[model samples]
Target: MSDLPVVVAARRTPIGTRSRAFAQVRAEQLAGPVLRATLADAGSATGRPLDVADVVLGNCMGPGGNPARVAALAAGLGVGVPGVTVDRQCGSGLAAVLDAVTAIRAGDDRPRLAGGVESASTAPTRSVDGVPYDRAPFAPAGWPDPDMVEAAEDLARADAITRERQDAHAARSHARARAARDAGRFDAEIVPVGGVLADDSVGRAEPLLPRLRPLFPGGTLTAGTATRISDGAAAVAVVPHRLRGGAAGLVVRGHAVVGCDPALPGIGAAPAVLAALDAAEVRTGDVAAVEIVEAFAAQSLAVLGRLGLADDDPRVCADGGALALGHPWGASGAVAMVRLFSRLVRAGAPAGTLGVAAASVGGGMGVAAVVEVVR
Candidate 1:
């Protein structure tokens, strides 16, 4: 395997709520702003204009053409930079990040700009239930389950997960999110878009709390605890090392992608993380933080439970999670990585401090990467 690239710059857009101003924005609109911000961040970090070797982007939906290419142009990027799009359902962003890292290690590219943007505002057709098909007949042969939530619910039942436990986990996510946001931890990786300064929304016009109580019946997972249907886009970037430090946060230590049974859908990420750790030759406890894509309350909790992690890891869904923060399919992974790296940078963690990012795909597939914060 090639050595991990030196990540020069990364930036993410402020997440917005469903039907908010960001809802009408195109991937070009979202991706362009962050790309410029990334280069700017790169210039400051390295004290020079980054010669981007490649661009890898993640987006679940957007204008038909290459949003990455459109973003490059919108950001005034030059032609020598080749770009590719990655889609793995909601996991595309992390996948793009891994692909970029893999390329850098293999000497295929240097100083690459890789990240993702998900414009839920422009999401293509999907079932009201978020399934990929309108009718049973439209399903593919041997198609695994289409809905992640349903599979998670099934996993809960099979594992005998109690509703009370699910509720508590959801609450913890919100409380941590509240604390993190209040503490400005999110500011590390977020760049305010050029045109917008603050987020104003109907669902998130205020803090998450009892007001969301009504959203989750039986108090199993309160709206305050769950991620909302928010519209937003975000990006992160990587490049080769001549090393000038931005914060010297992390080096891409090792990355691996593994497959698992698709029957349980979201549960696939569970094995994916384990496999990545084994592949990277790192132990679980050695990791300082873990960012598993929480598609649902149960799915998020399920992975931790399987790994024997209790509610408190100081690892956060702070700022909430997909249930509360909203899941813009394509941008979710990049957002998760941005959050993890930002947290590590703030804490001044050591090289031994490892972080994991995982996401689930339709038809029971899951993918993830392991990053070591190389200070």
Candidate 2:
């Protein structure tokens, strides 16, 4: 049996724009259904119920009670299946999946379910002292901790990513997403939740992108060029390659989490992707597919440019990305992996086909994973 960890199933709930389709759903409620669906799909693929060793999840902005355990119980995985939650801001989900992969590679043969969830609409209001705050500071007082938007704006200026280019990139994302959704390319990976059968944000941004004003004065980014705040959950089932039973799946190749200058946090994924690819002994041109969390058009373009990929490279987010699908913070990273699984595994790519999933984190960090298709 190969010691490599293989992902046999991937699933996600329809992404709902904040204060819309999933306004009343809690984080665990959002994660539970996807977890159940992913597990069932894995069981179907393997022809037996897996002895799941753990349930690991990434979350941000939820009520802090170890949401992973709550979500696990909610999925009826039984009390015996312990759960752990991780937080690396937007990169949490992919970090969780990599944690599971590390465990499996370290001689733990039992299967595991890992992913991320977020319910921005239902998150509790937080306060420090007598003042309310949207979120905790990503860096301490001595460190440069600009808001994510501000960081994106700085990155755009530094990279000379213009407003016209950003708008075009966003438009392309929406068009690709709408076309993929229309063709049912996203159907098999989406698990309906909160009565929301499909992503509510797709196909709504392309036409308005060019007309929208910049989010900040004299900035390249606009509301249309940024990912919508959303509610969603995404998960994948991981097990030893031996248990895959010759089924098609993603074989874990390499992963990395690296940090960069805090002031330009949005470009962090570039270094992480390079590191992961180097670890996997693969080059950017060798990758068949790539998925990076599209927090903002300028940010994504900067990352791609750093990695020597063209802005319109079809290999990157071929079916659109967070710009159209919505950004459910913690879930977006895991969502990237799920997208890769769909494009590579579900679409019947040849064995050894390479793919990459990556996300820029809030505190000047990036997380990325390299995976290969195996049958």
Candidate 3:
């Protein structure tokens, strides 16, 4: 245990709908406060101020400057700690977490702050060679690099996922999230941001599911089934197990990142999950909880099928998912981590409970990790 790495604290801001509660907040502004809060929590829990060696944050469409450095400075972490910004698209946040664990595993032993942040409302317009575009090119010319929604539509057609199923799944997500919010289940992990104590994007809107139209012609991926753009930030405090003191959290067991057909990016999570589970020496049945980003209902359903899980598997996103909470792009993966922390630590999940966090990336990639709750 002394040689392993463990999460000491995890916290995330209330997810804000795009152009709504967090429209005016910068990416750094969102991340810095969460980082500070996470550090404060970790410090109190461990009975000492954390000596974080570095800070790593993920961002997608934020400004060109290094947002992680800006966030660390904004958090008043001082000039001693450096920062790195990761850009693995949707997987960036989880990848940042894995990077911190990797550093700890390689004998660094020092604490590190890792998570993600996104400010979709304030994201700068991206362009290729000065030609304004909605997103930067992910693949070279002549390769099938359809937009994410188109890729989800492809998955839906290939996997025979219907609009009905997608809508049903989205509705279930909303109901579960609303129930959790009403029960105050999220209070332990969510840190207030901009005076928002609960996820502002979640609401009772199951009736609106059928009314929303698809992004493409005759496509099944509708606005109600897919996650909308959102703004948020999340932070995790990671340290060697020897330094964890008495705090109970998830022990870093294993991780994997895998690539897939860029044309069907939605299927990436399945393989990544399998690989990570194999590395962790655990089977799907051994997992007590799961958190997979709901990039789209079609893709999420496809991943579930590939992983041999039912659409409503009790172990998968049991509380809710991106479809209900909103997708803050780079921040979502870390949000998944925070969710795991809530379930395995704050919720008093039994010791040795296995949990997994996974996400499908924009460029036909996926990232996954396996963790075990420890006391």
**Candidates' RMSD to native:** 3.9, 0.8, 1.1
What's the best-to-worst order under lDDT? 2, 3, 1
lDDT of 1 by residue, 101-174 (tens): 77876776557777788776666665656668432221367756445545666666767776666666666665
Candidate 2, 41-116: lDDT as tens digits: 9999887889999999999999889999999999999999999999999999999999998999899989999999
Off by over 4 Å in 3: none
Candidate 3 lDDT for residue 29: 86
- Overall lDDT per candidate, in order of appearance: 0.68, 0.93, 0.90
For candidate 1, what's the RMSD? 3.9
TM-score of each: 0.86, 0.99, 0.98
lDDT of 3 at 97: 93
Question: Which residue pairs in candidate 3 have backbone atoms (N, alpha carbon, C) closer than 3 angstroms, thus clashing?
Answer: none
Please give the distance, in angstroms, between residue 358's alpha carbon in candidate 3 and its true position after superposition. 0.2
The ten-residue window of minimal lDDT in model 2 covers 239-248
Name the top TM-score candidate: 2
- TM-score for candidate 1: 0.86
Winner on TM-score (1 vs 2): 2
* Best-to-worst ranking by TM-score: 2, 3, 1
Q: Give candidate 3's whole-model lDDT.
A: 0.90
